[model samples]
Target chain A: MSKIGALIFGFNEYSLEIANNIGHKFGEIEIFSMSGAKEALEKEFAYPINRFDLSEDWGDLNERFDMEKSTAFCTLDDTAENIFLTISLRSSFKNLIIIAIAQNKESADKLSLAGANKVIPLVQTTSAMIADMLDKPVITEVLHNILYEKSSLKIAQIRVDKDDYFDGKYPTDIEWSREHGVIVLSVMHEDMSSEFIYSSKAKHHAIKNGDIFVVVGYERDIEEFEKLIGSRCDVSWSHWSR
Target chain B: MFKGWIVDIAYAINVSDSYIQTKRFFYNLLENDSYRFKKYFDMVMMALIFASVFIFIREVKYHVDDSLLFFNNIIISLIFLAEYLLRFWISSSITEVIIEQSEYDLMLSREFRLSKALRKIARQKLEYILSIRAIIDLLAILPFFHQFRLLRIFILFRVFKLFRYARSFQTFVSVLATKKFEFLTLSIFASIVIFVSSVLIYVMEANNPDSPVNTLYDAIYWSIVTISTVGYGDITPITYEGRMVAMIVIIAGIAVLAFTTSLAVSAFTEKLDEIKETKTVDDISKLKKFYIICGYEHISKEVAKQLVKNSNSLIVLDEDPKRVENAKSDGFVALNYDPGNIDSYKRLNIDLQRQVKAILCLRESDVENVYTTLTVRSIHKKIYILSLLMKEEHRNKLLYAGVNEIVYPKELVGMIAREFVGKPVAFEVIHALRSDYTNINIEEIIITPRMLRNAPLVADLHNARYRVILLGVYKKERKRFFFNPIDSTILEEGDYLVVIGNVLFIREFERSLYR
Candidate 1:
């Protein structure tokens, strides 16, 4: 298997947090600070820090890292700089997955347009959601465990390579959660647009090759389902060591 | 002895304690906005004002029965007379003046002269009589003296009494009052144009045999009618000079009309936001229980969406006008207000502890959220407050600021991003569930009395039959949640069942509970 590595840019709280949480998950990790070397030297980060400017050509980066398997993160505090970094990284390496952090909706749109694979808006929508259900401690704990703590539960996306099993089947025809012990959340079509499984568009559409199904379940159950369905999971089934 | 005497005299009556109590009651009903009885009193007074005005207007065009006229002229006016007297009585307390005079006499070590006390009391009553509101009230009762032909003109002032009963009318007046300078300038411009046009038309057209403007008064009327764009057509000019004057007056009229309209529109536009904010506050106060979200960012939008789905009322407040406008466009009751300002909460005018279910401080900064929580806490000590913690270190600070719940959005997002880097599918699932882009929902359904009355065990309900994963049950009495409760656990009232599944299936399961 090819090694999974992450290249995190910007030396800030969000970058450090992502680094600390996913330290042991990836095979290799590197940090690039956009600031001067003096400031980088002053800060003690768990990962070795390197200095990189947004304008620099990425010849060295391409040579040092396997661009296809590596993921780049643009976590700069400045919205314009982050978007510029995303555009630079995307233009240099088409296969390198790029993620970014945005302060608001406008910046999120700009970052996505700049070629970020995923844009995490620094919005309280996710956190403050549990406030209305504060009385339901169990739901809070379940969500807490899923987000912050490592549990046996895992979420994965599997691509349909062999269409024989599901080519003519509709999403609503099968009880994926009951039969396979996996909750099918959404289906990403060939056009890259995804819809919830229960959505009208997803429910009526016939399954085809190159379609991706996002599912959540235990690691063992996902691997079993992957083998039975003749599909390859994007995330490996290896146990999370954290 | 002096204090008892002062209390009696303060009410301007040497009656018993019940008299004082009755006066105090009437005072609350008449003037206290927060008093419950004031609403009913305002409603009655508003109805009377409308009725009296309608009757007076109807009498001009339609014949009213003699008895009805007598009832309206006497009975209604008598009611207004009683109201006027009560207002005059409550406007100033003679007892307070007497007490003040006695205190002053004692301070100076001099005798309390009866004439001095009488003069002070008379001055207080005179101030109330001279006040504009009091004068309107007096005019409202003038039709009672129907025999006095000159005083009958004051009967129309009954409409002015409506201003006191309808609060919105007062707001409108106050908003217009702010543009006093512009209106003054416009009125002055209009008057100069009217005066010149009226004199010119009178001089030019009055001598013409066929001109309708036979008198200076007719010319003045024509000038006013033309300038107002009404053009009554009853008055017209025949001579060429009069026609030229007419053209000039017409052009000047358009300018005056346009100027007045623009001035009014601009004035209202400036005050429109304030009026809307006040209306939103009023609407929130009417709600039995609603949430107050003190920020209109993305998170607040999401919260408001979910709250609307749950049938929970909420008002979104933000300091940024753009965000507030965005929230309004999104169909939420939103107001532009700084959450940290105590005046914002005071403007809501709701019994916070009773009417507000919770107050969410979702500002982008920890300091702002803390300040918001502090402001809310200062207003109501026990109202539930939830704050979004921007930094982990500020969690304790938020709690200290009287926040009942603290949520850290960045920390959650950071953890999710890490998971996404390692296991992309997991990230997708979690993201889909949290967002509205998917049909999946994690909902909490409270066990109804019927379900509890059935006395079914946890295993008997068959969550798998409904195809929903029951995560746990929150026991209300214990204030605890039992995760994946044992099959033998008996269902109880007030227990919230936390389940995750398709929204349709959740609804079906909830409906089945009643069966």
Candidate 2:
């Protein structure tokens, strides 16, 4: 059995971050940048990056990777391109695992229909959420929890239901820290826009019903948070429920 | 008999209360019955009840043998009467003893223990006698009085008592008890639909001379027959409006009937699923601290077998159903589901992610393992991930994917072969130490804050008369393992104490330090 290499399609902030976060785990790392030249990505990542058009046949992919062993990650900036990449790769490599990213539910459905094994929805505040996780002791602690999994504390996404208490309040008003046993990661607006609570724009955003908050806490503490805010909080990303 | 009553009062006073042998036997027979002697007792009682019922049913017939019927009736009546008296005797309360003690012996005042005890006994008797089982028992004997036709119904009630003896019938009754709400809902909806349709048909066709529903009652019967799809052809709608109502009724009947069928199917499936889950619950406990091996490949199997041998807890997930069933049959906890599926991962209760010791990703396809590692890392970044490297390049990929260790089988075997040729004695010794389960073992124990709070320091550990040799102390802060540390080396919380010793000594030593 050949060791699986990573096939990252498209070049974007998410693509770059994902490449960096997951680049070391693969035997061979290749980036298919639609807009950038090979020089930039190779210099940046110290790995091979090729300029390619997704519309073209990826016949060379079979030679580069054992089609039976490689995983194709479609992290193209545009949802449609990712869906396109998913379909193209799936058509070529019938046995390979194809993962694609979607910006919303509709694209997720499209990517899934296009034969992506997993479609992770990229929320608006993902970068900011990552930044929040990188904060001084919090990042180390979060990393510790993720790496060692030695604590019961978990990250949960909760929707802000209709509540009288938080209707007129700002995001900064709620003490979602040690006192409440929860650290608010980000807040998703009714328009599907999301921002980390620490961001300048989010700090001023007024709390409203139907907004979703991503928080990190223990199960009981999360339940307690639900009780206090009267919000419908979920312990997992429900899109994965299917 | 009077002396016996007096003795009962004396004994009750002597012991405060008594669980007499007869009382216990009868109590168990009625209340705490199992598939034992009580089962046989029930079978016998059921047979007798059914026989008496059979005789009564025959006597109701025109040409029954009168003389034999009378003899059998008298015999069955005597047995039922005796059983009934025995049940009554067992139900007697110690309340009377307390009452007598309070009222006459202790000379307690009104509204004291005496009156309360008497009231309790009276209430117990009232409750017992009025209970359905007790009523059925009483009715079974009353059938000997064939004078009244109404008593014949009670004789039929005796057959209902088979529910107590037959397991399948008992389950039927139990399922009905749980599903009464659904059945009730269906019945109520049916009734409403039937009533409305009947009224509409009756009102619309009342003036039509050709209509079979000349009367309101006939329209109701016609409506029910149409809705049930059991049309007897005796009644038919004549007017166009009446025919439309009948068509609507038929269509609505199918829809409502399908809904009822769906409810039954869902309920039955839910019950089966509950039973299956509960059986698994008994096979394994809620994972507090355990290892998760993602695939049951040969490599992962070897890993899991060792974990089990060492008494470590684990759950194995394999995409292959046959492999899953195979592992389960071998007395290991296994689940058949694609580990790459996030929902299956969620089912793993990854929220309590810390309980996971480590994830051994040994999928035949390294790509799947990489995805699994990425997913597991995304959800629980702190969990240790060990993957078997299928290709040389996958090492870096797996590491980038957040795999803690990538074991290359060929490389490991090659290294071991080289060691066997160059340093045979050392290899043998190392292998022997680990393989000799009954004698030697290597183990790691972490130093917790609780240990620092109560137990002796690291220096004291060296002199604690331990037969085990201290191999190293892993410092969490510095992320370094100091081998052969000096006695004065200060110990910190979260230090791993790596040691080699006799298996028994290691076990005892671990127990002492952890305790």
Candidate 3:
């Protein structure tokens, strides 16, 4: 099994925040800065820092860490620099997971095109949505518990190993959240493309082998769901160790 | 027995139903501009005022026809007299006044005094007659008497009656009325200058035979003409002292002219923004419901854009002029008013119970957001306020300040990042659903009273025929969101169905359910 590690680019506020918040979850973390090591020393940044040049081939990265097992965060304050870093990292490692911070929708689109697997737009669109949905107090409590507070609400990806059960089952065939004890959010195809289960397009697609079901539920419920579906859990968060 | 009978008659007249109805009808016709019937009444009144003034002007220069004279003198006068009496009658209720007087006498264990009640009623009517509007109305009707030469002079006051009909004229008067202090000061200064200059010119030029300033009247007229810059040139002072006096008066005239123009211009400039703001408020009030955004920042912009997409009217308010301008350029109704100011809320003229759906305090700082929330809450006890909490520590303070909802952007972003690191696909699905990057959206449709009456099951909504997914049902009465509610669960009024699908399909599903 590959060890879980993180490669964080840029020594800025956003990068520092992500490192400080989710840094310990990964087994190892390496922070890269465009500026020299002296500035990092002056600030006394907690994470181990490395100086990197944009034009250089990442020869030291491959030798130091397993690229497939590691996740890279491109969080440089400058949009162009972040995009270029994402492109370089993507070109070097095909299996590496890259998440980039975008200041706006335009940059977010550009970052995605530049091979970032996920783009976190720095705007408050998500928060605004959650705020609008706060009329239902239970949802707010659930979301808050899942986010800032520790709770049993685990979001996991279960790989479909047994093909016969899901061979011809559409996403809407069974009640997943009620009878199954899990809210199946989306289904990821073998090709890495995913669609939200509730979407109209998702209604046409059938679940099959090698498909991954992303679900949100309690710890015991998720485990039970995994056993019932006869699928191995590829990844799970929220109930993991600090 | 006779006295008792007389008292009964008076009581009957006081409570007469037809009398109250007639009075109410006239009150609505004259005072309620929004009443449909008042529009017609106003038009007729305007036509009469114009016709009477026209005839009065015609009579000044030429002979008037006898029939037109009779119409203006009799028909219009009778209408005016009726209007005056109606206005007086409505100004105070005699029945209420008499009832109160009799009640007071009974409380004191004394006989009811008719003369005392009459005195009180007369004083109230006198107060109404002394008012400026009533005085104008009296002058307008007096010209119809035509027999009193002095009352005929009041015919000019008929023109002032036009002020009552035209709303724009009232606005203009109000705008000038705000500069009462400045105008008062300016007029005093001008008067002093005119007085001194006229006296000086008279003393210097009256001794000469060539001078037209033989009396104080001529001097005053000359000074006024010079000071106003009319330069009639009918009077000239041949002496050097008089010419010097002319020079001083002319310079003073120019000074007074500049000061007056600047004062008027400043007053208009100050009132122009207020007028525009009032118009915006009026327009918003006309909407059945609307939202007020306290700041025009990125979060607010996003919320506003979404609200606009959902076809909800909103007004963006920002103290920052630049942000306000940006919002305006982006095709939003934006006002440069500070959210932390109580006067701004007062200016909105929000009816505490309706029209305003919510106020979103999306300012960048916690202090500003909290202050805005407090200001809004202080004035509107029940107005829904949603504030953006910049820091987690300020959450309690915001809630304490009476924010109905607090959205912490940092925590939300942090959560997204954590989820992105662990389950990228789930992150993608959620991000796509929220950003409208994909055509999918998680929308909440309220099960209105129309739908609850039918008592549809959740299973019906979950059917594939709707072409949407029923994620959950938010039971409003219970204040809980039941995840994937049981198929047998009956939908209740105010319960919100959280569904995800293409926007068009979701709308279709809502319409079908509502139907």
lDDT of each: 0.78, 0.65, 0.78
The sequence of per-residue lDDT tens digits that candidate 3 reaches over residues B1-515 is 55345456667777889987887888888886544587788778889988988998899889999999889877887887788888898898877777778778889998888789889989999999999999998888887777877787776776788788887788788988999998999899889989998899899988889888999999999989999999899997878999999998899999989988898888889999888777776676566788888988887887787778767788988999999999999999999989899998777666646778788898879999999999988887888888888777899999999998777765656666676665555555555655556677767778888877554788766444666767677788887767667779888887888776778888888887766
Better of 2 and 3 by DockQ: 3
Candidate 2 Cα deviation (angstroms), residue B135:
3.4
Order by DockQ, highest first: 1, 3, 2
Model 1 chain A poorest 10 in a row by lDDT: A233-242
How would you encode candidate 2's per-residue C-alpha lDDT over B179-284 as one tens digit per residue?
Answer: 7798898889889989999999999988888777888899899988888877798999888898999899899789777877787666667676444544454343
Model 2, residue B300: C-alpha shift (Å): 16
- For model 3, the stretches where C-alpha displacement exceeds 4 angstroms are A1-3, A9-25, A30-63, A77-95, A109-115, A124-156, A166-187, A195-207, A214-225, A232-242, B1-132, B140-160, B174-271, B285-287, B460-462
**CAPRI-style grade of the A/B interface in model 1:** acceptable
Order of candidates by TM-score, top first? 1, 3, 2
Q: What is the per-residue lDDT of model 1 for residues B34-146, given as tens digits with 9 covering 90 to 100?
A: 66779998898888877777777888889988887888789889999899999998988776677677778879997665568889889989999999999999987888887
Candidate 3: residue B478 Cα off by (Å): 0.7
- lDDT over C-alpha atoms for residue B448 of model 1: 84
**C-alpha TM-score for every candidate:** 0.70, 0.36, 0.69
Clashing pairs counted in every model: 2, 15, 0
The docking category that best describes candidate 2 is incorrect
| RMSD to true structure for each model, in Å | 7.7, 25.7, 8.1
Better-scoring candidate (TM-score), 1 or 3: 1
